[model samples]
Target chain A: MRDAYHDELRALTGRLVEMTRLVRSAMSRATTALLDSDLPLAESVISRDKDVNQLCEEIETSIFGLMATQQPVAVDLRTVITALRMAADLERMGDLAVHVAKIARMRHPDSAVPAEIRDSILEMGQIAERLVTKTGSCILTQNAELAQELEQDDDHMDRLHRRLFRMLLSESWEHGIEPAIDITLIGRYYERYADHAVRVAQDVVYMVTGSRVGE
Target chain B: MRDAYHDELRALTGRLVEMTRLVRSAMSRATTALLDSDLPLAESVISRDKDVNQLCEEIETSIFGLMATQQPVAVDLRTVITALRMAADLERMGDLAVHVAKIARMRHPDSAVPAEIRDSILEMGQIAERLVTKTGSCILTQNAELAQELEQDDDHMDRLHRRLFRMLLSESWEHGIEPAIDITLIGRYYERYADHAVRVAQDVVYMVTGSRVGE
Candidate 1:
C-alpha cells in the first residue's frame, strides 16, 4: 500500500509536467497562429485547451485522493497542496493561450498584430514559449533555483511589454482605435501568460524549499 | 470536539465572507479613484490588498489545519476544499482590484476613463460591486440558487464591457492611443473582477448543491 501511494504521488508530479508541456505547446502554436494569420492553427490551439483543462481536473482529483487516502504529512502534504496551486496556474496559462488563439481566430486572414508591433509581439511570444518550456523543466526536475530564475527571464518579457506599450502610446501610432485595442490586449495577454508561468515556478520554489520566497 | 469542529467550519465561512467584503471595498475605492483622479484613494486600495492577501493566507492555513486535524470525510471534506478554492478566487479578486487601483495611480490627476466612456465604466464598477455583494450573501446563506444568479448579473457587466469596446472602437473615438489602452485595461480589470465574483458564487453553488453548475 505504501509503495502504491508513492507511485501515485510520483504520477501526480508527472501529470503536472505533462500539463506544463501541453501549455507550452498551446502557447507556441497560438503565438505562431497570431504571427502568421493561420486560422487553422489558431483553431487547433483553441480546441486543444480542453485537453489541458481535463488534465488539470484529473490531476486535482488525484491530488485530493492522495491526501484523503494516504494522509500525506509534512513536506508531502505541502507538495500536494503546491501541486494543486501549480495546476491552477497551468490551467490559467492554457486559458491565456486560448485567449491568444481566439484573437487570432477573430482576426482571421488578417494578423491581429499591426505590422509595427508584430516584431515585438513575436519576441514576446518567443519569451513566453521559453518561459513555459523552462517551467516544464522546473517541474520535472524540482529545480527550485532554476524555477526562481524564471522571474529574471520574466523581466525580459516585462521590458518587451513596456516597449510595446511605448510604441502604442507613441504620438505617431496610426493604427486606429481597433488595432490599438488589439495590440494593448495582446501585449497584456503575453505578459499575463508569462506572469502565470512565473507564478507556477514560484510555487515550485516554495514546494521544494518549504519557504515563501516569492511574492 | 465535533461541535468545536463545526464551529471552526462556520468560522471558515465567516472568514470567506470577510474576504469578499474586503475585495468589494477595494473595487469600489479603486473605481472611485479612477473616476475622480483620486490618487490617495487609489493608494489606499493598493495598500489594503495586503490585508486581503494576509486573510487568504490565514484562511488557507486554517483550512489545511482543519483537514489534517479532523480528517473530515464526505460532505465535510468537500466543504473544506471548496473553501480553499474560494479563498484563492477571493485573493485573485483582490489582486484585480489592485490592478485597477494601480492604473488610477499611474494616470494620477487625470481620470483613466475618458468622458465618453466614463458612464459605461461606472456601470461596470457598480455591477462588479453588486456581484461581489451577492457572492458574500451566497457564502453566508449557502444559497446555491442565488449563487447561480450572479452569472446573470455578470451578463450585465459583459454588455457594459461590449458597450465600452464599441465606444473605443468607434470611428469618432478621439481618445488617443494611451487613453484607449488605459480604458481597455481598466475595463478588463473590472470585467475580471466580476468574473472572479461569479467564480466564487459558482463555488458556493457547488458547495451547497454538490453540483458543478458553471464552467
Candidate 2:
C-alpha cells in the first residue's frame, strides 16, 4: 500500500512535468510570436492557452483525488501540494505568454514595443524559463542547493525587470502615454513570470528543507 | 489517538490565527506609515516584522512536531499543510506592507506620489484588511461562504489596482522615472496584499470543502 501511494505521488509529478513542458513551450512561443511579430504564431499561442488551462484543472483534480485516497504525508504530501501550486504558476506563465502573443497580434507584423524593449522582454522570458526548469529539476532530484540558487537567478530577473521599467518610463516620458501603458504591462508580465518561477523554487526548498526559505 | 491528532491539528490552526492577527496588524501599521509618510512608523513596521517572522517559524516548528509525533492523515494532514502555506502568505503580506513603509521612508515627510494616489492606496489597504480579517474569521468558523465573499472582494481590489496603476503610470510619465517607480511599487503592494488575502480565503475554502477554489 505504501508503494502504491508512492506510485500515485510519482504519477502526479509525471503529469506536472508534462504540464510544465507544455507551459514552457507556450511561453517561448508567446514571446517569439510577440517579438517576431508573427500573427499565426500569436494565434497558435492564444489557442494553446486553453490546453494549459485545462491541464491545470485536470492536475488539480488529480491532486485532490490522490490526497483523498492515498493521503500523503512528509515528502509525499509536500510533493503533491507543491505540484498543485507550481501548476498554477505554469498556467499563469502560459497566460503571460498568451498576453505577449496578443500584443503581437495587435501589432500584426509590426512591434508594439520597440526592438530594444522586445529584446529585454525576450531575455526576461529566457530567464524565467531557465528558472522554471531549474526548480523542476531540483524538486525532482530533491536538490536543495539547485532550488536555493534560483533565488539569485530570481534576483537577476528582478533587476532586469526594474531596468526594463526604468527604461520604458523614461522613454515614454520623452514619447507619450500610449506607449507607456504597453511598455508597463510588458514589464509587469515579465516580472510576474519571474515571480512564479521564484515561487516554484521556494516550494522546492520548503519541501526538502522543511523550512520555508527567506523566513 | 485520532482524536488527539485532530486536536493537535486544531491547535495548529489556533496558532495560525494568532500569526494571522499579528501579520494583519503589521499590514495596518505599514499602510498608515505609507500614507502619512511616517518614518518612525515605517521603522516600527520593519521592527515588528521580526515578530511576525518569528511566529511564522514557530508555527512551522509546531506543525512539524505534530506531523512527526502524531503522523496525522487525510483532513489532519490537509490542515497542517494549509496552515504552513498560509503562514508563508501571511509572512509575505507583512513584507508587502513593509515594502510600502520603505517607500514612505524613501521620500520622507511627504511622498512624491500624489495625494490622490495615496488616498486610493489607503482605500486599497482598507479593503485588503477587511479581506484578511474575513479570511481569518472564515477559517476559524470553517465558513466557505465568507471565503467566497472574500474572493469577490479581491476582484474589487484587483480593479482598483489596475485603475491606480493606469492613473499613476500616466501621471508619472509626464514627470520622470522615480515617481513612476514609486507608483508602480505601491500598485504592486496593493495587488499582492489583496492576493495574500485571497490566498488565506483559499486555505479556508480548502479546509472546509476539501476542494480547491477556481481550479
Candidate 3:
C-alpha cells in the first residue's frame, strides 16, 4: 500500500511534466503563428488548449483520490498540494499562449507584431519557451537550484516587455492606436506567461525543500 | 477532537470571508483613486495589499496544520482544499486592485481615465465592487445559488471590457498612445478583478455542492 501511494505521487509528477511540454509547444507554435501570421498554427494552438485543461482535471482527480485513500502526511501531503498549484499555473500558461494565438488570428493576414517591435516579441516568446522548458526540468528533477534560474529568466522577460512598451511609446512609432493596443496586450500575455512559468518552478522548489523561495 | 477540528474549518471560512472584505475595500478605493486622481487613496490601496497577503498566509498555515494533524477526508477534505483555492483567488484580486491603484498613482494629478471613457470606467468599478460584495456573501453563506449570480456580473464586466476597447480604437480617440496604453492596462485590471471574484464564488459553489458550476 505504501509503495502504491509513492507510485501514485510519481505518476502525478509525470503528468505535471507532460503539462509543461504541452504548454511549451503551445507557446512555441503560438509565437510562430504570431510572427508569420500563420492562421493554421494559431488555430491549432487555440484548439489544443483543451488538452491542457483535460490534463489539469486529471491531475486534480488523482490528487483527490490519493488524499482520500492515502491521507499522505507531512512532506508527502505538501507534495500533492503543490502539484495541484503547479498544474493550475501550467493550465493558466496554456491559456496565455492561446491569448497570444488569438491575437495572431484576430489580425489574420496582418501580423500583430509591428516590424519595429517584432524582434522584441520574438525574444519575449523565446524567453517564455525557455522558462517553461526549465520549469519542466525543475519538476522532473526536483532541482531547487534549477528553479532559482527561472527568476533570472523572468527578469529578462520583464526587461523585454518594458522595451516593447518603449518602442510603442517612442516618437518614431507610426503604427497608431490599433497596433499599440495589440502590442500592449501581447506584451502583457508574454510577461504573464513568464510569470506563471516562474511560479511553477517555485512550486517545484517548495515541493522539494518544503520552504518557499525568496521567503 | 472532532469538535476542535470542525471549529478550525469554520475559522478557515471566516478568514476567507475576511479576505473578500479586504480585497473589496481595496478595489473600491482603487477605483475611486483612479477616477478622482487621488494619490493618498491609491497609496492606501497599494499598502493595504500586504494585509491581504498576510491573511492568506495565515489561512494557508491553518490549512496545512489541519491537513497534517486531522487528516480530514471526504467533504471535510474538500472544504479545506477549496478554501485554499479561494484564498488564492482573493489574493490575486488584491493584486489586481493594486495594479489599478498603481496606475492611478502613476498618473497622479493627471487622471488615467479620459472624459470620454470615464463613465465606462466608473461603471466597471461599480460592477467590480458589486461582484466582490456578492463574493463575500457567497463565502459567508455558501449559497451555491448566489454563486450563480457572479457569472452574470462577469458577463457584464466582459461587455464593459469590450466597450472600453471600442472607445480606445475609435477614430475619435485623440489621447495618443500613452493614455491609450494606460486605459488598456487599466481595463484589463478591472476585468481580471471581476474574473477572480467570480472564481472565488465558483469555489464556494464547488465547496458546497461537491460539483463545479460550469462543468
Candidate 4:
C-alpha cells in the first residue's frame, strides 16, 4: 500500500510533466503562427488549448483523490499541493498561448507584430519558449537548481518587454493606433507567458527545498 | 465529530470573507491613490498587500490541515477546493491593486490617466469596487444568483476598457507615449481586477450549482 501511494505521487508528477510539454508546444507553435501569420497553425494552437484545459481538470481531480485516499502528509502533502499549483500555472500558460494564437488568427495573413517591433517580439517569444522548456526540465528531473535558473531567464524577458515598450513610446513611432494596441497586448501576452513559467519553476523550488522562493 | 467538521467548514468560509474585505479595501484605496496622486495612500496600499498575502497563506495552510484531518469528500471536498481557488483569486486581485498603486507612485505629483480618460478610469474603479462588493456578499450569503451577476458587471468594465483604448488610439490623442502607456496599463489593471471578480463569482456558481459555469 505504501509503495502504491508513492506510485500515485509519481504519476501525479508525470502528469505535470506532460502538461509542461503540451504547454511548451503550444507556445512554440503559437509564436510561430504569430510570426508567420499562419492561420492554420494558429487555429490548431487555439483548438488544442481545450486539450490543455481538459488535462488540468483531470490532474486536479486526480490530486483530490490522492489526497483523500493516501492522506499524504509532510513533504508528500506539499508535493501534491505543489503539483496542483503547477498544473494551474501550466494551464494558464496554455491559455496565454491561445491568446497569442488568436492574435495571429485575427490578423490572419498579416503578422500581429508591426515590422518595427517584430524582431523584439520574436525575441520575447524565444525567451518565453526557453523559459517553459527549462520549466519542463526542472519538473522532469526535479532539479531545484535548474528551477532557480528560470528566475534569471525571466529577467531577460523583462528587459525585452521594457525595450518593446520603449520603441512603442518613442516619439519616432509611426505605427497607427491599431498597430500600437496590437503590439502592446501581444507584448503583454508574451511577458505574462514568461511570468507563468517563472511561477511554475518557483513552485518546484518550494516543492524540493521546502521553502518559498526568495523567502 | 461531524458537527465539528461542519464548523470548521464554516470557519473556512469566514476566512474567505475576510480576504474579500481586504481585497476590496485595497482596490478602493489604490484607486483613490491613483486618481489623487496621493503618494502616501499609494504606499499604504502597496504595504498592505503583504497583509493580504499573509492572510491567503494562513488560509491555505488551514485548509490543508482541514482536508488532511477531516478527509472530506463530495460537496464538502469541492467547497474546500473552491475556497482555495477563491483565496488565490483574491490575493491576485490585491497584487493588481498594488500594481495600480505603484504606477501612481512612479508618477507621483502627476495623475496616471490623462484628463480625457480620467473619468473613464474613475468609472472603471467604481465598477471594480461594486463587483468585488457583490462578490463578497455572494460568498457570505452563498447567493449564486448574485455571483452570476458579476459576469454582467464585468462586461461594463470591458466596454469601458474598449472606450479607453479608443481614446488613446484616436488620431487626436495628444497625451504622448508616456501618458499613453500609463493609461493603457492602468486600464488593464482595472479590467483584470474585474476579471478576478468574475472568476470568484464563477467559482461560487460552481459551488452552488454543481456545474461549471457557461458549460
TM-scores of all predicted structures? 0.98, 0.82, 0.99, 0.94
Q: Is candidate 1 or candidate 4 better by TM-score?
A: 1
Show model 1 residue runs off by greater than 4 Å: none
lDDT by residue (tens digit), candidate 4, B34-68 = 88999999999999998999989988888888777
Chain B TM-score of all predictions, in order?
A: 0.98, 0.92, 0.98, 0.97
Clashing pairs in 1: none
Across all candidates, what is each one's fraction of true contacts kept?
Answer: 0.56, 0.12, 0.91, 0.26
- The parts of candidate 2 lying over 4 Å away from their true place are A37-47, A53-92, A95-112, A140-145, A148-152, A169-173, A202-215, B169-177, B212-215
In terms of lDDT, the poorest run of 10 residues in model 2 chain A is A171-180
CA lDDT scores, all candidates in order: 0.89, 0.76, 0.93, 0.86
Question: Comparing 2 and 4 by lDDT, which wins?
Answer: 4
What DockQ values do the models have?
A: 0.67, 0.23, 0.93, 0.47
CAPRI-style quality class for the chain A–B interface of candidate 4: acceptable
- Winner by DockQ between candidate 2 and candidate 1: 1
How high is the lDDT of residue A136 in model 2?
69
lDDT of 2 at A114: 76
TM-score of 2: 0.82
Over B1-215, each residue of candidate 2 has an lDDT whose tens digit, in order, gives 77887787778678777766876787788888877777898899888888888878787778766766675567776777678778878888888888888888888887757766767788888887888888778768888888889878888988888887677546444555566667766777878788887887788788777788863
- Sort order, TM-score high to low: 3, 1, 4, 2
Q: In model 1, what is the error at residue B124, expressed in angstroms? A: 0.4
Q: Which stretches of candidate 4 lie over 4 Å from their true place?
A: B1-4
- In candidate 2, position B203 carries an lDDT of 81
Tens digits of per-residue lDDT, candidate 1, A48-93, equal 9999999999998998788778877678877888898899999999
